[model samples]
Target: MVRDRLSWMRFCGLGIADTVPDANTLWDFREALIKADALDALFNELDRAINQAGFIPRAGQIVDASLIAAPRQRNSD
Candidate 1:
């Protein structure tokens, strides 16, 4: 679905000439963040901003628990 969608780059605020990164690029970036121990801090900052914006309900909001499947990788073997 992502491969078929050209709007992701625009949604990410990238210029039309900029290429959207593929799954491997996203994974490597995530790995780098984890290696630097920055992932938790990033999440905390996002959560803090959301809370400050009153997005969290006082009674607690029910979040969708569905899991999104990742794209399959081809085996070289």
Candidate 2:
């Protein structure tokens, strides 16, 4: 019999196949992700376009960006 090399942890009847770190470590990771502002990414790109992108990247910028809701569309029609 070949044993699978993956480790499993149970969370509310669901199997999470990974090594278990401490709860405090998990909390720290959660905090880190919470602080990772994804909205800041677009602002950062716009900032670079205005400030650090020199000329080439600015010229190549997309003028139109359409915002689409993800959940309502689900897999997109």
Candidate 3:
């Protein structure tokens, strides 16, 4: 999804030509953070900051399904 979605790429600060990490790489990184016991701390900090900024989490989700035109894929032999 990160590679296919421009919004995700932008959120990750990646350019169109940048290589996105594979699933295993992401999983390993998360495991390392968990081993260091930092994941919960990170989430707590994020929650605190968002709350301080007046953001509330509600039950439900909103998706923007805007149509976008993309270039055709070309296969090279």
Candidate 4:
């Protein structure tokens, strides 16, 4: 999935010169966080901030969607 979204990721300043971090890098980062015992703390902080910001959904559904288009192929008669 990340490979397919490389352009969007680069646009967000995640990588440089058409090169994005591979799956190993992401896995290593997650492992380091787990070893440091910070994952729970991180989740707690995110939950607290979201609740404080009044983004809690109430009795309604939330949907996220995106659209991507591909170039048309040339036709040969």
Query: All models: lDDT?
Result: 0.80, 0.56, 0.93, 0.77
TM-score of each: 0.54, 0.26, 0.64, 0.49
TM-score of 1: 0.54
lDDT of 4 by residue, 1-74 (tens): 54577667765576545566688998998899999999899988978888998898454677668777889999
Find the 10 residues in a row with the least total lDDT in model 3.
Answer: 55-64
Give the range of the ten consecutive residues with the poorest summed lDDT in model 1.
1-10
Task: Compute the lDDT for candidate 2.
Answer: 0.56
State how far residue 12 of model 3 sits from its true place (Å).
1.2
- Worst lDDT run of 10 residues, candidate 4, spans 10-19
Ranking by lDDT: 3, 1, 4, 2
Candidate 3, 19-67: lDDT as tens digits: 9999999999999999999999998998898899899966488889999
Residue-pair clashes per prediction, in order, are: 0, 0, 0, 0
Candidate 2 lDDT trough over 10 residues, lowest sum: 1-10
Error of 2 at 11 (Å): 7.4
Question: Which of candidates 2 and 4 reaches a greater lDDT?
Answer: 4
Q: What's the lDDT for residue 46 in model 1?
A: 80
Candidate 3 C-alpha error for residue 69, in Å: 38
